[model samples]
Target: MLNVDGLKNGIVIDHIQAGMGIKIFNYLELDKVNGSVALIMKVSSKKMEKKDIIKIENVVDINFDMLGLMDPNITVNIIEDDKIKEKIKLSLPKKVENLIKCKNPRCITSIEKYIPHKFYLVDEEKSEYRCEYCDEAYKLEF
Candidate 1:
């Protein structure tokens, strides 16, 4: 019977895998936000058995690509006037830049300081990505 108030205008990040709420919270820099933010972890869910939820009291700019990369199962709900205005389903991003670094020692990215690390989805089922320059593979583990 834990009760949390509905947001009048804000964003609700739902369906975060259990134990990931803190990571998402930190990634979003919620601690530095001036508005109210509630991070509820380990909530019961029939779909996931356990999940985390983050409620922000004011709308904030979010990088959806980074969010998707962190957890593709997450859903973003935009609230306005205490009602859901939009529901966004996240999936693995097809392309990402500067999010994941090319770990290959001989990669050009390692030699060039000005280059932005870039990766492209190579295998969706395996959550695998390849470095755009070096073809080094990186896999995301949920």
Candidate 2:
């Protein structure tokens, strides 16, 4: 019976994969923001059976590309005056720069710290991304 007050004007990130809410919270640096942020983890869901939710009490620019990489199934709900203004469904980004590192030791990005880690969406249905440099493949569960 956990009850959280609704946001007056902000954004709600819903349908986060279980156990990933903390990662998203840190990635968004919500703790550094001077606003109320509510993170509810492992909540029961009809679609997912278990999921995580984040409620931000103020409008903030969110990196949709990072969100897409982390979890494409996530849904973003824009709220204003305690009502949902819009619903945005996240999808895998065509390219990600500096967000995810190439694990291949031989990759130039691995040696060159200045080079931004770049990955391209190679498989949408499987949520697979490949490093632009070494052709290293990364698969993420959606």
Candidate 3:
């Protein structure tokens, strides 16, 4: 069995979908962090059957909105003094900027390099987002 030590003061990103942990790890730039970080993948879970977990040995800033978009099922646990200080459940963000690109060729965002790519959640069930400027639809696939 694989064993990973618990954190004393850091964050635990739990319930990451199998195979998605590496993406999240890379996105968070865990490789560059000075603190100890552990990426455990393909752990058996009763709730999910399989999941990934990331443990950090020092507190770090995270963008929860981006995480929600990537995987709404993820949960964040803050650890302090070897105990869980707080638990944060993630959900799809109502609005996001610059994370998703507008694909419409004629959209202003496409023409203007300075324009930020903006999208609004149109369908939570479908994981659908629409470009704020062009109304172009983008469906997230995970």
Output the worst ten-in-a-row residue range by lDDT, candidate 3: 1-10
Candidate 3 Cα lDDT to native: 0.95
Per-residue lDDT of candidate 2, residues 1-142 (tens digit):
9999988999999999998999999999999888999999999999999999999988999999999888888999999988899999998899999888899999999799999999999989988889999999988764
Better lDDT candidate (2, 3) = 3
Question: For each candidate, what TM-score against the reference?
Answer: 0.97, 0.87, 0.97
Cα lDDT, model 3, residue 124 = 98
Off by over 4 Å in 2: none
Q: 21-104 in candidate 1: lDDT tens per residue? A: 999999999998879999999999999999999999989999999999999999999999999999999999999999998999
Point out where model 3 deviates above 4 Å. none
lDDT of 2: 0.93
lDDT of each: 0.96, 0.93, 0.95
